[model samples]
Target: MATHGQDPLLHSEVRQASTGGYFAGYAASIVLMLAALLVTQQHVLTYPAFLWVIFSLVVIALVAQAALFFGLGLSPAQAWKSVSLILTLPLFVFTIGLSVWMFHSLAPRVMPDTMPGMDMTQQPTLLE
Candidate 1:
């Protein structure tokens, strides 16, 4: 019964993307990115704290993109999708956290402690 040019998946049940929503999502993403760039370039945070700040900003941007672009939300139509994402979020977080941990833990072991131009003796020890 379907027409050759008609796609069943594009039926009324599927939510259409709105231009306003798309623009809002795009703007929010850009703003978040610029904020992160500013924080990094200005040295708003130092070393490990800077990394954490950037990570948090990225997570916020991800949520904004999901809500505006992917239609992820709490409405009846999107409840299941929202719940599914929430359920799987822990796995995603765990995977990324573990990957970072592994890389940091292994780096000192795999790479030389001192660079060619730097003297190991010049570096301060925790006991100092």
Candidate 2:
């Protein structure tokens, strides 16, 4: 029987490489998220739709970082982490979808019926 040192499945070099990659990916994700926040705060991307796109990209980056950090190996701990992430993916999608739907549904009810400085209604009609 091969010991851990000589085992085909677990190599010190591979573990080190995986750790380094995970750290690097996580650092990059943090930087990207911060940059996105700064851009939004500065009004560099003022449109709500564009901001949502940026948020989606950040979510994707976060998932990529998690996968890199947790899913690269077959050790028992890594396997558990990967399984948890896989199971949570659907929940994440559902939460985002439900939140967006609720926000859009409630916006008109909460907004004033007319614009502050104009005769026209603040609510836009499809034909307008």
TM-score for all models, in order of appearance: 0.66, 0.52
lDDT per residue as tens, model 2, 39-121: 77776554887668687878878767766654445565467667777789899999999999998878655655533553345
Model 1 local distance difference test score: 0.82
Error of 2 at 89 (Å): 1.7
Model 2 lDDT on a 0 to 1 scale: 0.69
Pairs in clash, predicted candidate 1: none
Candidate 2, poorest ten consecutive residues by summed lDDT: 112-121
Off by over 4 Å in 1: 1-15, 102-128
Best by TM-score: 1
lDDT (10s digit) by residue, model 1, range 9-52? 66533545788988998999999999999998897567999988
CA lDDT of every candidate: 0.82, 0.69
